[model samples]
Target: MQLSFETDVEAFRAEFAAFLDEHLPRGAESLERPRSTAHIPEWARRWQRLLFDEGWLLPGNPPEFGGRDASLLQQYVHLEELARRRIYHSFNPQGLGIIAASLLSFGTEEQKHRWAVPVLRAEKTAALGMSEPGAGSDLASLRTRAVLEGDRFRVNGQKVWTSGAHDADFILTFVRTDPDAPKHKGISVLIIPTDTPGVTRRPFGSLIGPADLDFNEVFFENAEVPAENLVGELNQGWTVANGSLGHERTLLWLGFAERLEDLTQDFRPDGVLGRDRYATLVMDLQALRLMGSAALARAARGEQDVAALSVLKLFGSEAVQSATEAALETAGPDALAHPARTAPFNPMTLEDFYAGWFERYARSFSGTIAGGASEIQRTIIAERVLGLPRG
Candidate 1:
């Protein structure tokens, strides 16, 4: 697929760029720490509200839901430009991007009317409750249970590694509504209010060391939510979950592109060692970008399967790992030792910074493990994508 932007897309990009130029955070340079996850602050919420007022927050949603009824290309343009400018950090992505999108796909009319507008407006934040303490990538093994009783479902289980649970007003949770049935078949999705009587959220510090990007362990003790809270049909949550994964991977290419640009800025073409290393890194980065962009385009066109997303995830994660390694190598021993003067692009200090890079290294490996393991991705590619015989 051609990667070039069309005339209308170019206009969309220009408009988004102008918005970012006018509204990006002031005094943001003084902030010493880097946020791991995209957690929008109050100022950022005001910025998002501005976008909502202008019908730009949920660019992909229908116009009735406070969106522009934007085409896929238009949405891609918005995301690409935002990521290019590092403006994604200023939006409540979980609400406006992921959950809201999923809701639009599977939610009932009442569900959409109740949640979509607030979500797009940034009035309510949502957290994903898919991963549990015992179940991460192997979501089929999830033990979170929900039992039907009268007009409500009683939910009782714990979800770990839940980002923004403490700050979120609601959770889009996956639970087993039928323990006796097959693992994947018994699952169901629910939108539970975080302020429910039996709910408790505890913040768990990330290995990444970002204070606001706290992961959480959420406890649901016989939490009762209306039966109408269910998203899509019962025992079909896996389908919805898979759909969510596809949507996420579709947009991740923009992030990978942004990282690639950041990786390139550190290169010094005239320097002897710099020229050689930079050349190799840039080539690999371009290849990864090509693969990721292809996967995204295929997904957007609905030509790719859910398993194909795992391939993009694998390639994207590895590219990020390789790029970080190259950046560190370029810095040499001084990279180990923080430079006396910090570059605007490379703002991290070397001392008190071991934890961040270490976390990146660990999480690069974990990213493979998070969405799905590299092994799993390879299996899917081999058997599903490549038509290899199962062993």
Candidate 2:
């Protein structure tokens, strides 16, 4: 079957492909994924800067913001092509995808110039400050507080699971500014420079593998932040938080789809049972792609379907988990052997591919939790789409 679009959209896809051929690093598709989102090597930084300078960083935004005001369909095509090539536009996902997008949506001109521009240009990095120890999926239950003083706000609280915080220039933090108000209403967002006094960061490794220090716990003990750093109106942080999460969950399915596709080709399992499992996986992946396409079409038509996104998030993440597990089972003990750790990592080698199976399987678990856990997504789907009463 042939799927087609406007002449310009196809042209845009061709242009992006040619650009990748000319500028994308050779063997980038097989290069070992970075251990941490904040670990932007010199080459990766240069790549990000090149995308920004060439207006491919955020094609939906204006040119000054490293975009050309491309149409929704064009943006969709752009993302698809990038996903097909497994190319990353930036090392800091939250910084480029969530924080900067939020600032563009809600920040003042001065704030945009100060924070948003630097993040988009890859001149500075940012981390999202949400998901406290007590408030992972339930953001409204956060205990962090930021009180308004004469000219600055005194922030005294802690945020855990703050990705890339240790390397971030600033943190777009959510704090409770009005304790007397409702849980969601009392929240407010603050842009706190990581170097500010009383601010501390502690990096920690995750289950993905050793040397993967990707998440951090950030503390703000009487940290003084200027009042002007507020992104939107006071005590309106829930709105900003939702906006950030929306940006985050929007295109997450693309990566999962790409990974699952790669898995189907890389793992050749024997036996009828294993073959059947892989066949099921391939069908699931096709379904996910169709769902994503439908969601993109709805978005292009100016429709916002929150429930559809929740469905995609739920299905795509779990599908990846299953596919990775299948790949490990197919490779058996060979997949468990650790490949020799080497510099300038390339995964295309047979040894590297087998070694990565276990790590990929372990890392797939994070997808089920990040950007709202699978349980949270199921709740959203049941309550919103299925119209089922809360249990």
lDDT (0 to 1) per candidate: 0.72, 0.84
Q: After superposition, how far is residue 313 of candidate 2 from its true place, in Å?
A: 0.7
Cα lDDT tens digits for candidate 1, 2-118: 878689878987887887788665565424443433355565566567777776776766667666877777888887776565554334556666788789899998888798667
Best by TM-score: 2
CA deviation > 4 Å runs, candidate 2: 26-35, 269-273, 338-355
Off by over 4 Å in 1: 1-3, 28-39, 210-213, 269-276, 296-302, 305-308, 329-366
lDDT of 2: 0.84
lDDT tens digits by residue: candidate 2, 1-391 = 3356889998988887898889986566435455556656666777788888888999998999989899988888898888776667888888999999999998999999999998998889999999899999899999999999999999999999999888889999999999999898989999999999999999998776456787899999999999999999999999999999988887888777887787777654554127788788889889999998888788878999999999999999999898878768877876665655544565323234234768878878888998889999999999999999989
TM-score of 1: 0.85
lDDT of 1: 0.72
Q: Estimate each model's TM-score.
A: 0.85, 0.93
Candidate 1 C-alpha error for residue 148, in Å: 0.9
| Candidate 1 pairs with clashing backbones | none
